[model samples]
Target: MNMSWKGVMPAMTTKFTDDDRLDLKMFEVNLKAQMKAGVDALILGGSLGEASTLLEEEKSVLTRAAVDMVDGKIPIVVNIAEQATKAAMNAAETAEQDGASGLMILPPMRYKADDRETVTYFQEIAKSTSLPIMIYNNPVDYKIHVTLEMFEELLKYDNIQAVKESTRDTTNITRLINRFGDRLKILGGVDTLALECLVMGADGWVAGLVCAFPEETVAIYRLVKAGRIDEAAAIFRWFLPLLELDINPKLVQNIKLAEVATGIGTENVRAPRLPLAGEERAQVLSIIENGMKTRPKLPDYLNL
Candidate 1:
């Protein structure tokens, strides 16, 4: 599964010790469970992995754990988003050396770019790695939207194979699919929007919710692939609300909660970010507990 650009690839949470060190065992358990559930890819060191909260060393530890568990059964793509090209390149190189099958580059943080810098940024990262690169174009979260022209330019890099379109706008997915088509892998980066994205010709999901519900999410993708759009839509109905919650401000916390509530992993996260607590925590747990109640549990999710 070299650089799989399709199906449910969960943005895995980077587990942390109470002292804020990387929890390698928890990470390994999560990765193994996801693979057993048949996820198409393991997206580690990503938003849900809380990439911004991690030090380079911690990310390295997490990446190593993921690649080891996946064992090349599926593509292992890590998100490497640093403000400077060198830092991003280091992360990319480390992931590649550690056996990652691909890289997903988020725009540099804190100072999301206008058009020119955005194009240059991707070009620099693309130049640094031999691994297949997936550009993460999430303007809402990063305030940096790589335009269609920018994508066309990035397309020149043989290794710049995909774009995780997290724009939350189906129209943009349709626009990109119309213009680029098979030239680029158009992945749905948001879980709530996956079906709409698929209908608009997006090839797959770089999902956050899949960490908690891998089998269900993969089932949706398989249905879509089998041309059972109605069945896929049926699954989406149970999934979309939780997926929509993931797009909310509490996304990171909620995703961790989904993992914790369902016993796939812990909700422990590092600071600058904090775990959900008080009523906020209760509400998120309630959502996971309540929603998961109606359907039979998705395999790999711990049963109540």
Candidate 2:
């Protein structure tokens, strides 16, 4: 990706109402807090925001709220992915108009398509708006794989400048970097492996767990940026358990639960994607407690 960036860009948390509506005011508080922590940018309305579950209007409201809070102080990238090309394009265009610095584009979800169709889907979105684009590549996250060949193909779009590579495959980092050279700004999308990525020639990170732990997340980034990989890895190793939970199928619930525990946001996930069940809830809590014991104490962003 062409966008010049660095430091922690938390995937960010979305606040929800007791009635399950998108909560904009609390969202602003969270955004401003991240900015105050000296984060590089904000990824609003992203996977962590439960984008897939939000109504388009609710998303627009949430987008406008973030842009307003940021007030041009930092970059804000919106995650706009939908099963339909038109929906994705419209959301991207709307975010651009709403003052987002960029849009993170994922493949048109829900249906499988040939490589040609998949490439075209993204190309059309690139053509639809002038917003800077970051190709969201998480094969595991989407139940689909974006190959090196596809990465090469997509790089042809000049504005498709950055990527959030979340496969947790360390070897692919050098491979993608060697192939793309400086043409792409490869961001480590998975939080647990973020330091390893930076050590292996990746730039920046897209982390979901950071929603409740910006201090540690940004601390690791600053360390890595200063070539303090060993120190960064120490903290990352301690925080790995919490970061890994971002991948659990119940990630949304787990994240919300953590937010509630730390007092950053709420545990009120939307309907259809229900909240945690007995065993799942217990397991996720155990993971968080273990992480707290290993990592630094919860930062000011949390209730703890």
Candidate 3:
């Protein structure tokens, strides 16, 4: 699958059973729904996918499962957030070998790599694999900003193809395009800012809430690109409350709760990250339920 790197690509939640094993059954259920809703790609083991908690073997399992299920329909992009340069490189290699079409690489995890270190890390990973890479430039959360200057240096590598723009500043999309032109693709990584990012000419959306609301997410992207601003804005307005859930510290649990409300997944998170409980649970549930109650009848935007 050639990665267009342009469309609604869900940063999917990793489904787990009551025993906390890889719930391939539920995973497949979500994957099929995303594909049916016309997403351009499938992204595995991302922040929303609980990449930090997943074992390396488990990431491989998720990658292979997604690869098998999607067949050749869309690209399966594996996320690599390893702290060590060697480990990140190895993960990139493994993802390619396991049939991933692309990778979303974060700046060195835990340690705040200086600009030089950050560029070197990405450059080395690019050297290790022929698969295309999307640098996850999430400085707000990750602390290591891959600045435009860093990108100027990193662009020499042909495999470093895109950036998952999560800086929370939508203008950075224009900044990247202004600087890099067509040299790099930009995918919106902030869920709340997705529509704005798209309107700003982002190549695509690396969506979080799409784990449960795939159709609505895709609808917004398609309508915006199709020049139906009012229609897209209408759906986005309805989606605003739920989309905001993706920015919270407990976003994984919040999105899983949304998934449960939509009848597509469970709220079972790994240990250290329990399901949203007490007042927090009720508040998130209120948001999810309210959204469900008012879930809009989507137009046939895809056909349009």
Candidate 4:
């Protein structure tokens, strides 16, 4: 499958049963909804998907389920976040065999590798699998930045094709375009910066809020790319509060809550992580409710 890598792709969250087992039914439901809403791709086992906590078997199950659910409607990319190069390589190979079309790889977790080590880690994984790779560069949460210089070296591989830009530095979008030109397809990895990044020449958006409000998310990307800034801005303004939820440390809980509110999925998470409660839950609910009540109407062209 040839993905354009130039539109809205949600870094989907993993759904769990009440017993915390992989909720394959709800997972398929969410995947179907995203496809129906016309998202460009489905990314499973991302940080948003609780990849850190998932067992190897669980990741394979999610990948296989996504591939089965999407069936060729869109590409399914699995995220690989491992501490060791060989582990990352094994994960990449497994994803490919499980029918994933691509991989989004982060640098070594726990111990932040230096620039050279980071480059080596990615290259080894790329060499191990034929699947296309998107280097995840989120310094804020992951703590290791895939610097421009490092990217220059890493992009030499044929399979290392794209970058998920989440440095939270808006200017880095322009810098990426200037430095790499068309060698790397840059996807906006932050929710709040989606429109700005698109306007600044980002090829696509790897969104978080889209897991809840897919139509609105795709509408914003389409409108902005179509040069309808005012229309896109209207949606963005209405979406800002909800999009803000994506940046919080408790984003998994917040987004899962939004999913439940929207009738898509549940708020059940795994061990060491619990559902939102008390005042915190109420505050997030307020923001989501306010957004829903005042949701912006899409233009006729959007047809949502």
**Candidate RMSDs in order:** 3.1, 3.5, 0.8, 1.2
TM-score of each: 0.93, 0.91, 0.98, 0.97
Q: Over the stretch 1-304, how does candidate 3's per-residue lDDT look in tens digits?
A: 6777899989989999999899999999989999999999989998888888898899999899999999899999999989899999899889998999999999898898888889999999999999989999988998988899999999999888899998989989899999999899999999899999999999899999999999999999999999898899999999999999998999999999999887789988998899888999999999999999999999997797
**Which residue pairs come into collision in candidate 3?**
none
lDDT tens digits by residue: candidate 2, 1-304 = 1246556788877788888887776776677667766788888777777777788778778777887787877888888878888888888888888778888888778897677778888889998988788888877867666778887788888888888887779888898888888888888988777888988888888888888777788878777777777777778888888888887777888887877666677777887777887987899989887766566753332222
lDDT of each: 0.81, 0.79, 0.92, 0.90
| lDDT, candidate 3, at 228 | 93
Q: In candidate 1, what are the lDDT values of residues 201-304, reduced to their tens digit?
A: 78888888888887788877777776778877888898877887788877888888888866788878788888888988777777788778865443322221
Q: Judging by lDDT, tell me the better candidate of 1 and 3.
A: 3
Q: Which residues of candidate 4, in runs, are more than 4 Å off?
A: 301-304
Clashing residue pairs in candidate 2 (N, C-alpha, C atoms within 3 angstroms):
1-161, 1-162, 1-184, 1-185, 2-161, 262-303
Which pairs clash inside model 1? Answer: none
Model 3: lDDT of residue 138: 86
Cand. 1 Cα-lDDT: 0.81
Weakest 10 consecutive residues of candidate 1 by summed lDDT? 295-304
